[model samples]
Target: NLNGNDLAATVGRVQLAKLESIIAGRRRVAARIARGLADCDGLDIGHEPEGAESVYWFLRIAVAEGAFSLSKVEIAAAVSAEGIPVNPTYRHLPAEAEWFRERKVFPPSDYPWGLPDYAGDRDAVYPCDNAVAAVESHFILSIHESWSDADVDDAVAALRKVADAYRA
Candidate 1:
């Protein structure tokens, strides 16, 4: 049955990329960003450099699909997913995209996908992913940023340390 005047074609089902798996990763990115901002260490963005190395992409999925945001519980999931500890929440705001946005920031899309380096190269005022890349790539973070990283593995160890401490 044709809804409009169109040529006949073979019948087939539409296929979508497994964005869910990629979406899951975004949660981790969000948590990581939130934690980094909340963390007192003051580590610069791009801790994982190339993008979410130690973090679990699925963490983002949980928050995106679940009730609470990336809280301590979500972080625990990230830890467990990453083979760390088994907690139910994140250290800081796991999927608290709004908070970050208020501060002119944004959260990752959740995983299987990947987080963008939003902050350009101007250095963050309070620690954040590359806003330039983040906004340009997704808009999870804000726009008035001067941070950027071709890769996000700049400082993973420190982020791991923060991710480890979270117990919820």
Candidate 2:
């Protein structure tokens, strides 16, 4: 787990500034955050030969836009139970869930949320399936397709507020 100082070490003084750039939606600045995030290859979230860099970009933007963290499993479970389809990709994961517990990390949920009946098995595991990615896609699409920027902001605000209100 990355304590504040540990994270600080990995993220560095300049890196937090980069993260701040991501928060502010300067694409150039967000690129720095992405690079820093890439440093933690231990997490396996950084690799994607696919279009997922854009996905990462959206996540940075969304978080910058007001989104914050939830317990990854909780988020995955919520999205999965929402009929959004979950892929439990923990199999063959480089690190076990225990490794991530140090950081309270949520493993990613995979793409193509709201799977069809036949596709659940196909889409339900990591290496190919991811839980964080699933929840992220669902909400990002929700923001992109049906909402205004103000609506997206309100929604991000609402998500954070709801999470905060439920804090134990």
Candidate 3:
């Protein structure tokens, strides 16, 4: 029942025609940023796995504990001050969502969570150490296909400046 209208279809076709070039531009920007930031200690600019290619929609950088004097928030703030857009990956964990905490995902009843076959306890507090660490340590940077080489360079420089300034 959900389908594109004539105008949407036309737009979709136009976008599809340029999708390859868009993806190539994104990949180029991401690769350049990655290479630029690769030498920064304590910062983890993710890598593409071998044999796989990614049209990176955004870049996620993880700050390792004890490697920097600044927290993730501090680092993100510093980068943002330099006019680079950055934000925490997740403000809160998935298990901490209101729907999950209230067990109201299906309304009237906790259908999925309370299902007899479900092993997870609706009331149980999940111990997500890794998830917590990631949420606390990771920041996201928006990358766009429209970004120029200078834009990529500026982002890299801002991040490096912050990291170097606060290296523990």
Q: Which candidate has the top score in TM-score?
A: 3
Candidate 1 residue runs with Cα over 4 Å from true position: 1-15, 40-168
Per residue, candidate 2 scores C-alpha lDDT tens digits across 67-118 of: 3354444543443454433332323333335433233333353223423543
- Between candidates 1 and 3, the lDDT winner: 3
Candidates 1 and 3 compared by TM-score, better number: 3
TM-score of 1: 0.20
Measured against the true structure, the TM-scores of the candidates, in listed sequence, are 0.20, 0.25, 0.77
Per-prediction CA RMSD (Å):
19.6, 19.5, 3.3
Please report how far candidate 2 places residue 136 from its true position, in Å: 12
Against the reference, the lDDT scores of all candidates come to 0.34, 0.38, 0.84
Worst 10 residues of 2 by lDDT: 59-68
lDDT of 1 by residue, 1-168 (tens): 456333332221111244454444454454555454454332223234465353333222122222223453444344345433233422343234544434433334432223365445333244445543232221112211112221112223333554446522
Number of backbone-clashing residue pairs for each candidate, in the order shown: 61, 13, 0
lDDT of 1 at 79: 37
Q: Rank order by lDDT, top first? A: 3, 2, 1
The alpha-carbon deviation from the true structure for residue 4 of candidate 3, after best TM-score superposition, in angstroms, is: 8.5
